[model samples]
Target: MPIPGNLLTTAMAVMPHTDPERAIQTALSLDIPFWPQLPKFDYTEDMYVQASEHFPGIVLDMTAKTLRFSMDKFLAEFEETMAHFDDPAYFDISPAYSAVYHRFLAMDHSKRKAIRGQLEGPVSFGFNIQDQDGRPILFDDTVRPFMFEFMAKRVNVQLERLKALNPNAFMFIDEPGLQFLFSAMSGYSDRAAKDDVGAFLDRIERPRGIHLCGNPDWDFLLQLDMDILSLDVYTNGEVFGSYSGSIRKFLDRGGVLVWGIVPTNMEPFSKESMDTLEARLIAIWDMLAKKGIDREWLLSRSLLSPATCCLVNPDGERTVEEAFAMIRTLSARLREHYALDGD
Candidate 1:
């Protein structure tokens, strides 16, 4: 599939809304609108829970609001689950899993530059969910492979569904857990994480993307064969500057960068304005340009977004709405300042 180019403002995975209709309306307001993951409204919309549907051995307790794996359950349902592994419909995300997915799909998207969908990444899901024995499913040799392949199938199914709505449809693997790979206590090694991610990306048939809201091994991630890299630039922008070589190669290969410039957290969000945020983004770009990466080239192949998902804000959905407004205004101002209006 041809990659979507010159895309502008969009958002991260989750939205802080309880209403699906309102959330879809907010999504359609963006240049590259995405379906909102409304965990506030339903536990099923939780990123990990959304990815857990139909997997063998997984158990969800609505009353306790918890999810876990069961070896006994997995053994019993293993054959049945594998039987439907090849069925695309088996991985389809129905309204039950996403309150807004089907509603978002029902909207008119012909004029959209592109549409985006997101799934909890295998690494994150594996680490977050534990087996009946309290060990992370990621450490389970048998279950880990099954989980990775299961996520790949889930991604492809959603990609195809979005493609039908817009040919430029794409999916992002939400992987905040990736930051753990760099920690001494993570147990999962960096090399193992990279190999797992590379293999997982290979299974995705359409353009693959990863969203890491925390700083990780930039050099390592930039080397992966993903079409887009979305990160929290509000906090990690300067740290990312040290990876100029990787950034240059990534952009040179026609990769897109979703610059998560607008702050989503309450502290930073309160201190920033359009002027300050613009200056911050330009400062990072200037730093890159000094290292020989073309500023104009970077602007042309970039998209703007809120630094991360907005679930932590105390002001609730209003804060998210404000952050997105800033993103739209900032995108337009930058495009005009850089004379990229034609592109």
Candidate 2:
């Protein structure tokens, strides 16, 4: 499992179909093009939309940016929706996803190494959605399983679509909320957390990965069945480096590691030179190597990224494209520097 000399970015970063032709043009420009989450086009593109849509007693005021679920209402719809999980329409993805995907299909992908599709993991989605009383859905016994089914179906659909285009296409479960699982209020035990993630990953096959934008219980993830572990290396590289034993074990078992070594913020992106960023990545490897992982093993298993999604500037959408261009240049320099394998 040699690392693909390609970059990865979430859908939150790219805008599609705002100008149909231009959107596709921008998508093709990336080294590793992925399905974009055009939230600006429609709020439904937010990670939780697929699961929230079939909530039993859901209340949404998109204009006001509010959502409150009704347990009673949810319970009623829960049976039907859960029973119809196999039906394609039951887990229909947003048009924003389809728009980018269709455009991706129409374009030439011969030069692309691997493309990616991402979804909000069940843990994060459950922790974020709340009942009318403001209680988190993760604490609700009835609603929890329903949410898992909802997201599982959604991920299955997305994976099927991406695999149809290319088997090398990667699917990732974004779990930013895992960082708070140990807090008193989250009510998740280590075993329960593993169970939740396992449920979400049950249908996912190889070439799948998990992206945690925040520092999390890395040990738990290391024990999971994912082929890749994507981290917020720009911020948590040291924390991750401390787990050198786990890193060695994971890589030894053929897992890929994506170092989110690039900074996503405009200030850092503008300030850090390519040499500085490359040195930063090398430093991380040096730390891991000291802990007994071979440097070449570390490099062979590594991928590069700009943490997660970078937000668009208040005044200009072009800033995002500029940032991505910087990322493309950085990716090229790193690959050439390491003589990494190409797609």
Candidate 3:
């Protein structure tokens, strides 16, 4: 499936509020509703927290929302866990998972193209999670491969649940931490990175997308066998533009470009109206179109989203709501101009 005309702000400001009702409320309000990831709604729903389900010998500090592992014990149990990776006990679909998903199950689907679900990408998961020695698992020879395998299988679990609702279930493997891939670790080669990421991408039978907010290896990501390459175009649009050849090939091969054009920061959010943001996106698109890319092809293969998740102020739920409104407004403006599908 191509990326939908529906807004990809599906994972927007779901933190800082613990009420399941708020997640449902937010999803209900979207032009193209999506399941929410409300870690604040349930600490257990935090990206790493939820990933802890398959890792044995990992200590969960609910108070701090961190996972600690005894390296020896984790490896000792590795074989046993691998044998039962498909067990229902390995994936915890609870609290916010049910809250957001149940609402999606009940949604009026006649007009919907697909459902969007999110998971922590293997790179980001290993980067964020630590061992008892406070070491990031990404750099660990013993644990990193295991983490990658664990996350790869975790996707299978998520897909099974999502496919039950919508066959065209789209999973956006959020990998914001990939920007640190080179700087934060040594001995991690592009080939190694490809293998690590490919482990998951190769297994996704349904359409899959990758979302990265920071400047990453565009050349590497665009060539992946994935459906969508979502980026923070509002901030890094020029960076991506520098790789015209690769971008052209990606589009030529039927990959979708999810233009993350809406600003997630407050300063830009305050200054830009829907018209201005739409213009920004058009300018970028026009540049690409001029480079021998077809305008209609680009429009048909693109999606609009905020550059990043909206940052929520401690007392500013309304501000978050406004951010979502801005995304929908921009999406509406794009649809008006492109005649994109939205019902």
Candidate 4:
């Protein structure tokens, strides 16, 4: 897939705002405006719960704020759920799941470079939701296939809706749980997870992307057949920069790397300025350039974002707002410095 033109700045999935209007406005202010997943406004906006709306056997406990799966419920409703697998409306995300999705769709996106939407990845969703017997649904043979298909359909419907607003629209899968793939305690092997992710990616017909907030196996992730790879450069720049070979190969294949350099937390956000962050990002680019990757090419095939979603913070939405401001400013400065005004 060809990289979207002029995708210099965007954001992760979740936002900290309780006001839907404010969240939508904040998203629309970016170079690549995205539909904000406002979990603070409603429990249904939680990524796992948001994606679970139509899935069979999944139960959401509003009082306890937890999710669990029931085998008996799955067996009872599996056939009916599979019957409408090809229907796009069956997997549509209603206003119940997102407070601002409909409002976002009604906005004017004509001037935006690109638009983005996101969902919880299968690996993260399966690992987070537990069965009645206290086992992850990912490890369940019967439910895993359906879960993957369900997520694929959901992405398709959302992507279809987004494309109507702007042709350059795309969706990314949030996989913070990817960090556990290689952990001995996870019980899920890295090879198995890779194969699972590949299979899931094959089902989506549009440009595919994945975002991980933690420092996962960089080599393993960069080697995947994805259009974009987003990571937390604010905290993991040193380790991620060490994977110069993988980064070079990924870029050579027309992959766009979303360098999430802005900090989302108050403590880190308070300690850095636009000048310092720009220097930090440039140092990493210089390191890669010394290893044979061109600096100009790196800037061309790159996007900017906060390190991760800002859902939990002491200062609430103010921290996330500041992070967004810094990235937008940094994007303009980088464009000027690299003489990329034509892009």
Q: Highest lDDT among the candidates is held by which one?
A: 1
lDDT of 2 by residue, 1-343 (tens): 3236333332233343355456556656765667565656556655566446655677777897666777787767767766776786556565543455556665555456667777787788778878878898888877777677767777777777776676677777777888887667555566676687786677665677787878887877787778888887878888888888888889888888887766656676668777887788789888887788987767766666666566455534464566556666777776677776544
lDDT of each: 0.86, 0.68, 0.70, 0.85
- Residue 79 in model 3: lDDT: 84
- Find the 10 residues in a row with the least total lDDT in model 2: 5-14
Task: Estimate the overall C-alpha local distance difference test score of candidate 3.
Answer: 0.70
Instruction: Give the alpha carbon lDDT tens digit for every residue of 1-343 in model 1.
Output: 2444443888886988888788777777778899899989899888889899999999999889999999999999999998997899899887788757888888888677788999999989988999888998887878888889999999999999898988888889999888876677455676777788889999997678999898888988898898988998989999998899999999998889999999877888899999999999889999999999998788777888899887877878888888888898888888888777523
Candidate 3 clashing pairs?
Answer: 18-41
Question: For residues 1-343, could you state the per-residue lDDT of candidate 4 as single tens digits?
Answer: 3345333888896899998888888887788888888777888888889889879998889888889999999998889988887789889888878767778888877666678888898889998999999998988878887788889889889888888888888889988888877777455566777787788888885777899899898888898888888899999999999999999999888889999999999888999999999999999999999999988777778998888887779889999998999898888888888788524
Range of the 10 consecutive residues with the lowest summed lDDT in candidate 3: 5-14
- In candidate 2, stretches whose alpha carbon ends up further than 4 angstroms from where it belongs are 1-24, 94-98, 105-111
Query: Which parts of model 3 are misplaced by more than 4 Å?
Result: 5-14, 92-111
TM-score, predicted candidate 4 vs. hidden true structure: 0.96
Candidate 1 lDDT (Cα, 0 to 1): 0.86
lDDT score for residue 20 of model 4: 82
lDDT of 3 by residue, 206-293 (tens): 5787888899888878888888777888889877887888898998888878777766566777788877887887787788888888
lDDT, residue 119, model 3: 77
